[model samples]
Target: MATTSTQRFGIFAALALVMAATRVHLSLFHHDIWDASWGVFFLAGFWLRGTGRWAFPLLMAEAVLVDYVVITRMGISFWDHYCVSAGYWFLVAAYGALWIGGSWLAKHQRGIKLSTLGMAVAALLVSENACYVISNGSFYWLSAHVPAPKSFAAWFENLGDWYLPFLETTAVYVGLGGVLHVLAVQLARLSQHSGQTQH
Candidate 1:
């Protein structure tokens, strides 16, 4: 619990590298699909730390690199790249990270309780939807500049474009990602327990 300066720096650096490398695949493969990659990022940055400021920049950096690399590989100039593409997702992730890191971690660290865990889980789910809605807001701005699809539906179309993929992907991504986080924490606790037993 008492993470030293070196430990904190090491954690941050390792996370950055892991996030950067995985993000490459996420950008290249899913490109348009928001799942598979980002769900893990949200969980890590959110649940792993309580510092909102640190989480925001690092997570955003990881996300940006994915997009930047992919767009460059495709030989597409991002000079006209929609700012919203970058900005809002960062907003969504940052928001979720802060919500989990600040609120959940703060409460849970105080004590282990079922109600606390349930509240944390509920917050995480709501945060996902909030991020989706925020991204759609980004789309709303992008749509104004880009060609709005000509149809009776405008906002609904934008909502569908992002929300559907978000929900479908989060279903798989969040569940798996949650398990990974839980396992990792359990492993850490196990190691600590074993060390204490040996002592």
Candidate 2:
């Protein structure tokens, strides 16, 4: 149990580090990397499911902090930033959808099999779409950044324009994460088998 707790903490720390490193790249001196914020949240949901009470809130706060720092660094007031609006709060829901999707996947996962892969892809598709909808919809409808006279057609068009890019970016990170997950699982199994053989 102690070892498990330590391992969980390590995973949490790693996720937090990834979030900081990727989410704040624009604010940092370099601007070469794409933001992995969405992937981090999904992976966190999968890896840190049991710790959501503290971990989820902590990650959310970290996201807000990153945004605040980035905006302030650009000479924009935190509250006055075009991204910061009532719609901004809806991000909590958007991210929650991702976290929940990850948690659901974790619950249903049954090891390294084609079925598991299918489930993972399904979960990612559902969660990512739901998240995109919440975040994009809120921003389009509620944020002042968009000019008035919002309409269903315009919103649908906007979704079509951005959805593919967001999905692709998230899929790239999540795919890497899936590879790492498979390696870890395989290594653990090999270690266990070796230990049994020695016994």
Candidate 3:
């Protein structure tokens, strides 16, 4: 649960580069736009350090930057821009908790089972659906506007409309997240071994 400044900076810098590259190369970056997000980076930090506290600030930065870029540059309402961003924070939380990597997923002696992964994927899809339904309108939910769903009695009636995009985006992001987690661990292990050799 502790680390040196060097390790932290190395991980942060590596993740930032990966995120920027993924955003720019979505069409050919091993995934599509829907799956784009420094999701891999987020989860990597989470598992490597056993907490994604670093990712929170990054995600927040992403949200704020996106809101401004979209609002000021493209004439989008600033508030509306963040409404849809809400779901991404939820996603960060989800990935941050992925303490495993499949049959091989494990953290601090705790391995992740297939059951956990399934539940996580389902939970994420539902969370994103709710996010779109609330932020936009179960339709556009474009900006940050919390679409007042007249009554809780029928709040979920428009869920299906938001399912496709959410699933597509999260699946690819989460899959990449798994990769990031492994990469971070491997990098850390490699660093340790290299140090041992020098010693």
Which one wins on TM-score? Answer: 2
Give per-residue CA lDDT, model 2, range 1-199, as digits (tens).
1128788788888888888888888456565777787888888888877778988999999999999999898898998988788889998999998888888888898878999899989999999999999999999999888998999999999999999988988888889989989989889899999999999
Give lDDT tens digits, candidate 3, residues 104-186. 23232332456656655554455444444543343233323445545444445545655566556656776766565557667
- Whole-model Cα lDDT per candidate? 0.57, 0.87, 0.49
C-alpha lDDT of residue 79 in model 2: 88
Candidate 2 residue-pair clash tally? 0
Model 3 TM-score is 0.51
Check candidate 2 and list the clashing pairs.
none
* lDDT order of candidates, top first: 2, 1, 3
Regions of candidate 2 where Cα sits further than 4 Å from its true position: 1-3, 27-31
Cα lDDT over the full model 2:
0.87
lDDT of 1 by residue, 1-199 (tens): 2246665565456556655666676656765444344454455554445555775566676666666777778677654455435444545554464346334544454434566566556655666677666655655654445475544377667677666666666556556655665677788899999999998
TM for every model, in the order presented, reads 0.68, 0.94, 0.51
lDDT of 3 at 32: 52
